[model samples]
Target: PPARGPLGGWRKVPRYNALCTLYHESAQQLKHLQLQLAAKEATVRELRGSLARQQQQQQVGVGEAGAEPARSLVESLLEQLGQARERLRDSERLSALRVEALSQEVQKLNQQLEEKNAEIEKMINQPPYEKEREILRLQKSLAEREKAQATSDVLCRSLTDETHQLQRKLASTAEMCQHLAKCLEEKQRKEKGNSDDQIATERSNQVFLQLLCFVHVLLAPEAFDSRDTSSRFRVHTGNQNHMHIQTKVEHLRGNSPGQPGARRTASQSEQTSPPADNGNSGSEGRAQGELRCPHCMRFFSDELSDEFLKHVTECCQ
Candidate 1:
């Protein structure tokens, strides 16, 4: 037999040897019985031939006195032959029983041999213990990997939820920032409009003060009297003062031409101008052509002395 492992085939060798020895011993016993039966058959045949010879001799010497002894011998031979036949029958029976038992023993040994062969084949195909242990180790590693995968899946889900929440917060913050920016822009625009209105009002007030000074200088004749030394000095400088007033009027007109204050001042100047004097109508007409309100760009007659002052007051407000 071929060996599958060091001990696998060696362990069965003793039993195989014992079975083979038993079979050989049984064959030898059967052969011995057969030889004994052949010997007994030959002996019985020899005894029958010898008895026939004795009977022939007795027949030939029928009247002799030795016939009695011969008859006694023949009787003894027949008895011996019957005993031999009985012994042969007994031997045959014993041999048949022995052969039957041997056959049954051989059959049982054959069945046992077949069973041993099947066991040997099974052992040959089976894996070794080391391979079985390796398979167990691999299965354990696979289980650990599956556990790690499950944990990773859970972590991924949590991270995904966090990312979604952060995105929503960012979107809300952006919207709030946009709203704040729009409110700040509207406030700045309103502040700028108020500042512009304040600056225009200041300019209008300064123009009104300048117009008042010009009107006072033009209408107040006592300030230009030549009797006093200070009045004579003022009369010498009146032309210069007139030029300065004209420059101021042109400046104010250019600076704020289309203001609502200017429109109100024009209407007031129209209402305040006095009627022309019949005696001095020609001189008054020439003077009116020369005098004008800077705020409304309207000429006035000299008889309307306080009209410019009243128009400036109304227009500046």
Candidate 2:
């Protein structure tokens, strides 16, 4: 039995050993698979890290390739900014010049406006007058003054003509007086020695003196009074006529060298004395404005006496 028990146990042991061998092989394969999986995971991590590094290297190469164009674009943008700044500075300078020109023009206009204002003020400040009327008044006054001057000149010319006529009359009267004086001197020379001649010379001298006084009174009315001439002439005219007639008779008779001169002396003495009654009658006749010619007994007016005397003197001459 014991030997038989040993043979059964050895059979059980072979079965059990077979089971254990199968379990061991399964565990070993699982462990090997796990180890293989862990190893693959590790390999996968390394490969991903290596791929990331390769992608970073590829991106660095691309950035290096694009760098030149980006730098050129930045340089062009900087140049455009510089050009824009220069254009802005030029525009500011032009604006300043235009402002200065406009300021000067405004100042000139202001000065002209001030001058016009002053002229307007002057016109407003004065008093008013009529320009046409004032001019007419002044012209009228000038015309009146000119007319007065012309009239005065005409009056002066007329007065000058009258003065020339008066001077010519005075010259003629002076020539007549000279001729009468020469005639008297000749007569005195012719009758130098006889007493009767002496008496005649004295009477002629008296008549010459009276005629000179009468001529002077006629020429210069301012020298003597004229009122007494007519009355005095009337008183003496009769005697003068009688003496003249006697002188003419003596001249016609012709006195001889032996004859006495007594008749002539008596006649001269009688002529020298006048009666008072004759003077009274002459005064009455003058008062009545009756002038008579002693030779012809003709009645005449005092106004006609000057013309009558001129006729008598021409007849005697």
Candidate 3:
């Protein structure tokens, strides 16, 4: 009977059954030859016994002519026995050669069987469908990995471009800030120079006013005499008028944005003088009438003392 293979089908071993049948046949033939040789030996033994009996008969007065026939028969039996032994020897040699050949063939068959069994085992462990599925899975995984790599490369390039754009924007912003800072510095420098020029002009005006006041005091010594009350009062009023003008000038300078410190210096330099006597309206009326420009001949009221002084300084010049 044929064996079942791993796939539940008949397993075909080529020439195995034929070799087994040939070996059995060879054995049977050898057995049959042995039996035939035994039969031939038994017949030879019977012929010898018969030939011995004939010799005894010849010794008991048998004829020579009859003995010659018996000897010829015995010679023929011996020749037949020798021929049977030679045939048996030939059969045994032939059987031996057949058995050796069969043994070699069986060894070759066993090696082939082992190879077939190995192939069957491999099929049972891993089928064709399973191998194909594994290959497909690996191919799909490789494709997915390649797709992910491509996406990552795109993202990296985009990020690099974005980073470069940000860097450019930052550089432009920094340059604009630097330009604004330089402009601001230049504006501040110009403002400082203008403020300094304004301060110098104000100081020169203050010096000229002081020189004019000194010249007027030197030319009118009798105006400050204590014996003349009306003259003393008028001089005090004029000094008050001068101080009021200085205070107004300091106030205007103080209000200016560029001359914040000038007010303090002007206030520190202001002179303190005695107040005038307010008991003489008649004297005040006469003093106001006499307050006339020496060169321009313009009469001025007491309230317009700063204007009057400016007119007198201009006339003197």
lDDT (C-alpha, whole model) for all candidates = 0.52, 0.50, 0.59
User: Model 2, residue 79: what's the lDDT?
Assistant: 66
Q: Model 1 segments beyond 4 Å from truth?
A: 2-47, 57-95, 127-130, 134-317
lDDT of 3 by residue, 1-317 (tens): 32455653334354767878888998998899889889988988887777687779778976555334366777887798789889889988998998899899888877766776677677677878998999999999999999999999998888677556544544543454345445434544555657555544444343333334434432443432435654422322245645644553443334333546755655454433223346444553565333555333456654565886787766555
lDDT of 2 by residue, 94-197 (tens): 54565455456556544544555555555445345655677789999999999999999997887577556544654554555566667766656655655655
For residue 271, model 2's alpha carbon misses the true position, in angstroms, by 18
Report the C-alpha displacement of residue 209, candidate 2, in angstroms.
6.0
For model 3, the superposed segments whose C-alpha errors exceed 4 Å read: 1-14, 60-69, 127-130, 134-317
Candidate 1 displacement at residue 84 in angstroms: 4.7
Q: What digit string (tens of lDDT, one per residue) describes model 1 on residues 33-58?
A: 66766676676567667657667867
Candidate order, lDDT descending: 3, 1, 2
lDDT of 2 at 172: 57
Which predicted model would earn the best TM-score?
3
- Give the better candidate number (1 or 2) by TM-score: 1
